[model samples]
Target chain A: MRILEIENLKKSYTTPDGEILTVIDVPGFALESGEQIALSGESGSGKTTFLNLVAGILRPDGGRIFLGGEDVTALSEAARDRLRADKIGYIFQTFNLLQGYTALENVLLGMMFGKGADKGFALGLLERVGLGDRAGYKPSQLSVGQQQRVALARALANRPALVLADEPTGNLDPGTAGKAVSLIKEMCAESGAALLLVSHDDKVLGNFGGVKDLGEINRAPRGGIEK
Target chain B: MNRENVGGIFLIAKKSLAQHRLSTVITVLSVALAAGLVMAVFSIRDQTYDAFTGGPAGFDAVLGARGSQLQLVLNTVFHLETSPGNIPWEMYEAIKENPNVELAVPYAVGDNYRGYRIVGTERSLFTDLEYRKGRKLTLAEGELFNPEKREAVVGSYVADKTGLKAGSKFNPFHGLVFDERQKHAEEYTVTGVLEPTNSPSDRVIWIPIDEFYRISGHVLRGGGGTYEPRAGEEIPDRYKEVSAVMLKLRNPQAGFLLDQTINRQGTAATLAWPIGRVMAELFGKIGWVNNVLSLVAYLVVLVAAGSILASIYNTMNERRREFAILRALGARRGTVFAAIILESASIAAIGAALGYAVYALILAGAAVVIRAETGVVLDVLKPGPALLAAPLAMIALGILAGVIPALKAYSTDVASNLAPLS
Candidate 1:
């Protein structure tokens, strides 16, 4: 089954200098369940904007987005949020765990907004990620690699149909970067969720089975600006 | 939203409060102080009014030798202040015989026994008087003093403080204040100890009028100093003058008639009727003090509310990323807004609940001071409007304080704020 399908997805912004910049214009994209793909792009090439539009974080200027075969374009803002929360999980370049919450609590926080929080399931997920003992540790207390592993666990917490990994290993060293991409792909396949991982680093993309370059696929002006 | 899901918002708010524990605690303390002060001030004001206006119970008016009515009530009823001259015995007899009079009790004050005033009166003061409505002045120990004897009735507080129970004997001092060398030659025996009246009468030492007259220097140092008679001769009625007369009329209207007859026509005495009005007037004059304290309490509540606002508002700049993270996690904008407001309201609710303890402390202190000064025991546990309103008002102010910060949180930009910090 196709987990995500998009057509003519477009997004742009007006510069304060009175110039309109077309940041993203994608003709077509589709990913089947359990399929893992990497979309590589240069810096400031609208890579994050494409992922944001797919995740429903940024509304498209024009186009239709279907996630798990449901038309996402027709949903209200709140409904889009619900759809995003219930059906998609996002992994940020930086491990974006709430600093105040413990590793276990961060996992539960992901479930809090979706499936009602289950302490037993959240603990099991942490145990599977080999951080069982560190469940009580806060994000600040964990090392860089451990924090990223925790973030990966949080993304799959809701068992969403689609997972969007934006530069998942951007902040890691070359050695840790190789391991993180493998762990993300293995977890996504185990959960049977389609993975759309984006990155600017070639070595990070080299670990993936199939890679698509955002610069070639995206029909939009480059170097407009990256927020 | 499911009930379990609703807890996520509360959880975020509660942990955020814990994260900023110092500010939360200080805000709670300030709110507690303001709420407590508000409750204490109004309680003390109310109990005081009840005690003062209630005056030495059962008497509608005080008749004294021409002078300040407040002075006469203070001296005659409360046992404070010096006697304002003295009314002659004939004048007392005439009022006692008046048709409007239900009861006329004469009191002559000249001396003290260890700082407690010695009020000379008839035995009827104990048998016929009501300390409070329908509550007679009953003996807690022994019997009433004999009218012709040098026996005395010690009020509850006098017994407690001076260790003067029934059968105890004490020498009277020459004046109202205590001085060892100035003790009178004769000693008066305490025949009884009165029960707790919760009024000024609970602090007096009562003796018979005839015996008070015969006390050695009283004849010579009398109200209008009279000629000293020989040792064995009885003091004449013409020479015997009472300091004031406390009158209880048959009807409330009788006080007006007595006031008109004595104050306007009689000329020999001043009648202070409906003693409540006099007390109310006194409260009205000193009311500004209450107003000032109330203003201060109000200002603290405002400042505490400001503190809540500033505390939450200050943290908004740092937590934009946090809100954006939650927003990206499927938490609604309203969820973030509610969390901020919930935090503020929680601080106030906790503070207001704790404020009752503060109220208890303040009121207990005020009760002690008031009781010592006026013998009016305040009920510290008594609830008032401020006690109920102050806390709720603080919570409302807290919610009001939360709005500006919550609005900031609600308007956070996800795409911009969610960017990883370098």
Candidate 2:
């Protein structure tokens, strides 16, 4: 089953200097169920833009996005948000856990905006991430790797069908970065969610089952545009 | 909790508030104090007005030396203000002779025992007068002062403060103030103590009318030449005077006749009919004071709301990413907006609820001073307009104050804010 299918996807933004900058113009893309694929791009390749378009976080200038065969791009902004909440889990480069909430609460926040947050399941997710004892610790209290593990658990919190990650190990040292990538892949595979991770680090890309280059797939002019 | 669950907005706001615990607590307490102050101001003003307008019930009118009716009511009815001047004893006798008058009691006040008013009157003042509608004065201890003897009937409050019980003797100062040097040579025994009437009557030290005139310093200002009475000399009726005369009419309607007959035409006295109306008018006269106090109360609430706005807005700049994270997680923009508004209202709701305690504290403090000054004991638990409405208004204002910050949160850009902090 195809978790996500996109065709003729395009996005652009006007520069502060008033010139139009085209960043992403991908002709086609598809990810199979539970398949983890990595996409690499230099800084200006608009890799994050593609993830955002697929996650329904941003509107494509023109395209269609089908998640589980349902056309998401045709939905209203609010409806798209609903679809994203119910079907997509996103992991940021730096762990975006709420500083005030406990580690368990951060994971629960994923399920919070979805159907509901089950305390027991959230605790189990924390335990699976090996931070069950530190469930009560805030993100500020956890180590860098531990925080990422909590984020990984949170990403799978809603039992998402597709997971989009943008430089998930960008902040980790090379050693911890390798471990974090392995943990992310293992966690995503266990949850049976298709994974699309974007990164510039070759070490991080080398761990994925397959990798794609954003520069080759997205046909927009680079213009040193921000990803 | 933001919006989906029972704990949505409150739970999330609670966590957010906890993250800035010090500022949150400070803002809440400021709001509490403001709510309390506003409620207290309204309460004290209203109850004080009620106490004054709801003065002692027995007297329908007060006849005093020709002067301000308010001064007469204050001096004669409330034991406040000095006597406007002295009315001749003949005026009391003349009003007493009216067929419409049920009873006329005279009061001659010029001295004080330890700052409490010393009111001299006939025995009929206590025996025949009712402090409330159907309640005559009762003695708490000892018997009523002998009408012809040198005896004092202490009011309950005077007795409590001065410890003036039966067999106690005290010299009166020359005026309505405490003075050791100006004490009269004559001393009077406390013959009785009055039960608490919760009225001005509770603050007076009552004595015989004859003794008040014979206190050695009263001048015979009647038709007779001014003659300072010598000891053992009897002051003639033609030489006697009373400060004010309280009249209980055969019916309340007859007070209008008295008001017409003496106050309207005769220059001998001023008649204050409908005593409560007189006090109400007195309250109206001092409405500027009420307006100033109310302004202060409203200002405090405004400042409290402003503080809440400042507290929430101050941290808004730093929480953009947090909002973005929630947005990306599936929170609708309205959810974050409502959450911010809900947080502010929650702070006010908590503060306003606690405000009643602060109201109790303030009212309790104000009660002591009010009772001392006006001799009226107020029931603190009495309900008024401020009881419920003020707190609700505070919450509404809190929500209103949250709008700007909530709008800021509503417009937070998820894509930009989620960009890694460089």
Candidate 3:
């Protein structure tokens, strides 16, 4: 069963030069339930744009994005936000945790817009990510690796059907990146959430079950800016 | 939003504000100072009006030699001004015998005991003059002044200031000036000390009218050469005069008839109602001053609202990433918008509350000094509707200040913000 799918997706942007630049033109894409895939791409290859499109943060100019059999592309911006909140989890390379919130609070924030956001479940997720002792620490107080782990815990808090990791270990050292990637994969597998891990690093790609290059999936021309 | 969700939003806003401690404190304190100033102005205006208009003496009319009615009331009733000339003893006799008059207390004001007014009147003044609506003057020590003796009854303020107990002797001055050259040769012993009434009379010394007439420089119309009645010398009725007659009417409606009759008949004295003409003129002259002060106070609050706007608006640029993160985390645009508004409103609410607290403290401190100086009691605990409404208005201004920043937060580009990470 497909957990995420996009068909004939198209997105474009107008530059300061008043030229319409197409950033993403993907003919077809799909992720099976509980499947893990590495989306490999060089710089400026629309990998983040693809993730943003699937996460419902940005609307495609023309496309059909189906998340759990619902055509999210057809929904209003507000409805798409609700769908993203209810079904999809996103992990940014920067670990985008609110600096003011404690590690536990960051995880709770993910479940804030969803129903049944229990503190016990949030604590359990923190403990599962090996940060239960550091739950009271703010993002500024945690190490990069520790912050990434907290982010992974937060992403899985709402029991999302699909998790998009956009270079989740990009800012870490090699050793820390390896450890963070392993923890992310383990957490995604345990939660039974499909993973689309976007990265340019070959070492990050080796851990995934399947791999696809964004250059092949995205049909936009190579010379244009991909944002 | 449900109650639980609203609670969550507030929790997030509270934590966010805590993160930016310095900016938050500065913003809130600025608002507090403005609110405190506005509240203080209003409180003082209310207390001043109450003190001046609702004085202890409930006289229906003050009759004095033809002059400013306000000055006549000030000199004779409030002891705030010098005598506006004097009315004859025959005029006082006529007023005392009038059918419409319930009580007529004569006042002869010229002398002062070290800056406090010395009013001369008969024993009837202490017995018949109502201090605060049927409340008569009660002595704190000794008896009322004897009409035949050259004695004085000191008010509470005079007793406190001059340390003049019942047995203390003090020479009266020729006029309000307290120079030794102006002091009379004959001394009047203090016979009584009146209790504190928290009125203008609290700051006066009362003496027998005859002793007031015999002061060395006081001239009698029919005779000269220090008109002092030596022991058994007769002082002609035509030689005597009193400064004013404070009348209490049997029926309050009679005050209007007497006031009109006195002015229309061109009598030697003019009748002035203290609460009506005197207070009306006073408030009319000072009402614009209050209006200007209130305008200034409101402008301060407006500047406070501007500070709130600047504080929040200045932070919107840095907070875009934070808002984008919230957006991607499943928070709706409206939720983020509402959260920003709630944050501003919370700051305003806290500031307004602190402002009122500061205002109360100031009033508490000022009340002691005001009571000592003017005998006006300021009650800080009594909150009027404007007290509550002021803070509510501040919160509304907070919400108004938040609109622009909330819109900026709502329209933040989530993809652009997250693209930095990519």
Candidate 4:
């Protein structure tokens, strides 16, 4: 079953001078559980833009985002938030863990926010990522690799069916990027979640099952994968 | 929302606040200091009024050779100024003998000990008084004045200062001057030391009217009196003149009727209703200042609240992404709004409480200075409406402060905030 679907989506920004600049135009796409896709393009390719639209973090000018068969684009901001928390998990390029909370506490923050009843599950996810010993340390105390693990733990804390990662390993060392990607893939496989990874790094392309150029599509009419 | 659920937002707020330690401390301390000032002022008002009325049932009214209402209140109610007339003891006797009168205590006050006046009245002045709390005046130590003996009952404050306990003797200077010839040349034993009432009564040395008279009359008759222990005189013949007479009416409404009756009868003294006079003169005269003070207090509180809002609003610029993250994690918009309000409310509450406590400490510390200077006891704890007035103002301030932050949090655009932090 298709866990996510998108129709023709459009997004624009109004400059301070009142000029409307079209940022993205994307045709429909769908992804089923356990499928990993790499969205690749040059800089300003709108890979992250498409992910934002699918994750319900940005409202497209015109489109429909169907997540788990629910039209999230038609929902209110609060309802969209609910949709995001329940079905969409996002991993930022920079692991934005709240600076004050400990790593385990940050993981718990996601679960505490979600409808999940098992708070300890956040800790278990950290253990699964092999950073259980660093749970008490804050983000500043953790290395880039450890912080990414904590971010991933938080991402999977709600067991969302779809995971959207924007340059997940872009900031990591080449050796650490390989480990982070493997861990994310392993965790997504274990959970049977559809993973949409947006990155321009050539090293990431061959690791995924499918690949597409967002630069070709994002600048095309309605920005579809097939220009 | 369930409190358990609300706990999550609070946890976030708490963590965020903890992260910004210097900011949080500054905010809390600023709030606390403001609140402390408000609270202290109110506490002083309470403590002052508390010691004044001593729970309200203490004295009825002052019957003096009334000139001005404020002056009469100052003299009789507060024992600060000297009453004008002698009011012949016969008039006090008449009121005491009246069937309608409950108790008529005559008072003669003029001499001072280190600036605190000595209030000479009949022993009934202390004994016949009943407080609202059902507590009677008992000597903290020693016996009440021996009626026939030339003895005095010193208030706790007076005893505290002079270190004169029961059975200790002290001679009175004939005048208010510090170094003056002793009048009537007799030592009066302190038979009792009254409990500290924290009122004007606390500062007074309560000697018998006869003792006050003997000293005053001797100064008049002998021309130059010294502490020469006069010939064995059981009760000095010169103990008749007094300063003023205090009349207690049988009914409160009867105050006017009694005043009419007393003044019309051409009595030696004048009649005054203390409560009526206090209401008319005290507030009437200072009402504008009080109103201005209230306005200033409100403006100050408003400014404090504005600063709080400004601080939160300023922080919100940096916190937008954080809120978006929270919302993405399933925190409701209301949760975000409430967290901001909670932070402001905490500051306000802490500030109010601290301000009140500071106000109390000031009053308590300055109690003696106030009593000695103005003869008005400042209640550092049991304040009047001013105490209540302060927190209500702060709460209003809290609400005002919370509004801006809450609205900012509510209007936070999650979509733009979380805009693909690439």
| Predictions: Cα RMSD each | 2.8, 2.5, 2.8, 4.1
| Candidate 3 Cα misplacement greater than 4 A, ranges | A224-227, B139-143, B147-153, B157-174, B177-181, B184-195, B214-216, B220-226, B229-237, B361-374
Across residues A123-203, which tens digit of lDDT does each residue of candidate 1 receive? Answer: 887887889999999999999999998998888888889999988898899999999889988888898888999998898
* Clashing residue pairs, backbone N/CA/C < 3 A, model 2: B1-B8, B1-B9, B1-B12, B2-B8, B2-B9
lDDT tens digits by residue: candidate 4, B326-420: 77666778878888888777767767767666666666677767867555565554536756777767766876788887888878876567644
**lDDT, residue A190, model 4:** 95
Tell me the whole-model lDDT of each prediction, alpha carbons only. Answer: 0.85, 0.87, 0.84, 0.71
For model 1, name the residue pairs that clash.
none
lDDT of 1 by residue, B63-163 (tens): 89797888887787777788888888877888889989878999988889888889889987877877678898889999999887889999898899899
Tens digits of per-residue lDDT for model 4, A1-227: 88988788887766667766666777767788778888887655567667877877678899888888999889987787667777777888877777888988787777665655365787789899998888899999999999999999988988989998889898899888988998999999998888989888888776887988776556543322211
| Estimated TM-score for each candidate | 0.92, 0.94, 0.92, 0.88
For candidate 3 chain B, the 10 contiguous residues with the lowest summed lDDT are B222-231
Tens-digit per-residue lDDT, B1-422, candidate 2:
43444344555788888888899899999999999999999999888788788757468888888889999899888888988998788878888999999999999999998899898999998889887878999998899988777799999999999999999999888887778777888899999999898888889999998888788777768654786766566777887788988988898779878888887878878998888899988788899999999999999999999999999999899999989888888887877898899889988998899899999999999888988998987767999989898999999999998999999999998888886421
Which tens-of-lDDT digit does each residue in B241-288 have in candidate 3? 778888888887787788778888776568887455576678889799
In candidate 4, stretches whose alpha carbon ends up further than 4 angstroms from where it belongs are A14-21, A216-227, B1-5, B46-57, B126-136, B177-185, B216-239, B264-268, B274-276, B328-332, B366-368, B372-389, B412-422
On residues A1-227, what C-alpha lDDT tens digit does candidate 3 reach at each position? 99988999998889888988888999999999999999998877888888999999989999899999999898998888888878888899888999889999888877887654679999999999899999999999999889999999889988999999998889999998988899888888999999999999989998886999999989998644744
Q: How does candidate 2 fare on TM-score? A: 0.94
Off by over 4 Å in 2: B1-6, B220-239, B420-422
Q: How is the predicted docking of candidate 1 categorized under the CAPRI scheme?
A: acceptable
Please give the lDDT score at residue B42 for candidate 1: 79
Q: What are the runs in model 1 whose C-alpha is more than 4 Å off?
A: A69-71, B174-182, B220-236, B420-422
